[model samples]
Target: MLGKTASDNRVFVYEVAGVRQNTDNDKNSYPFRSSSSVFIKVPYQRMNDEMRRITRMGGTILSIKPWTSNNGSGEQSNDGD
Candidate 1:
């Protein structure tokens, strides 16, 4: 993990809905199909590939957004003014 900074890691959150379970995806065992939308975390490198895969499995992406799970204990702190 040398020379790796926090900014170097790229991740995205995909809010997808209407995922259809079919033969091709059945083999892959995608068990996130439901009536509601699901959150899928995709790396930057596999963004396009994952999108294609989802589409192939009959999924509609509701939205795509850059995500980072640094909500607490990151670099920000509240100093009493």
Candidate 2:
């Protein structure tokens, strides 16, 4: 969970789209299809950095919200864009 601190207890989820594998990605030892959307668990403190990184990677940020369960059935608060 991101953004879990002594004072702040909120965790965030980042919904990213159009992330393609590049040379920077070491996981791509072989060819594979890129998923259109990716769900990233980001902490509040690192949100800005993560957003910047995502942008540099040519990914679009669809939405950002508070962390919920794996199924995303928990409460959702759109605190980040």
Candidate 3:
């Protein structure tokens, strides 16, 4: 098996919605408030796991994009947009 290298440390951002405040999310200090959506940082190694977890929590995965540093914010880099 090809071992992961430093170059494979890419991170992606997942924009999810419909994750309501529930018993599962009550442990979070900043619990989900009534909102349209939220952005979650997911590492390359944890994409599938995060997806499954989000699905189990009744959250819909809206968009998944490679995360890039925009100044100090982690966002999708789009030159044209």
Question: Which structure among the candidates has the greatest lDDT?
Answer: 3
As for lDDT, the candidate ahead, 1 or 3, is 3
Q: List the residue pairs that clash in candidate 3.
A: none
lDDT of 3 at 28: 63
- Considering summed lDDT, which 10 consecutive residues are worst modelled in model 2? 72-81
- Per-model TM-score, in order, reads 0.67, 0.63, 0.74
Clashing pairs in 1: none
lDDT of 3: 0.72
User: Candidates sorted by TM-score, descending order?
Assistant: 3, 1, 2
Score each candidate by Cα lDDT.
Answer: 0.65, 0.66, 0.72
19-49 in candidate 1: lDDT tens per residue?
Answer: 7778766775335455667677776767788
Better of 1 and 2 by lDDT: 2
Instruction: Give the clash total for candidate 3.
Output: 0
User: Which stretches in model 2 have alpha-carbon errors above 4 Å?
Assistant: 1-7, 27-33, 70-81
| Residue-level error in angstroms, candidate 3, position 38 | 0.4
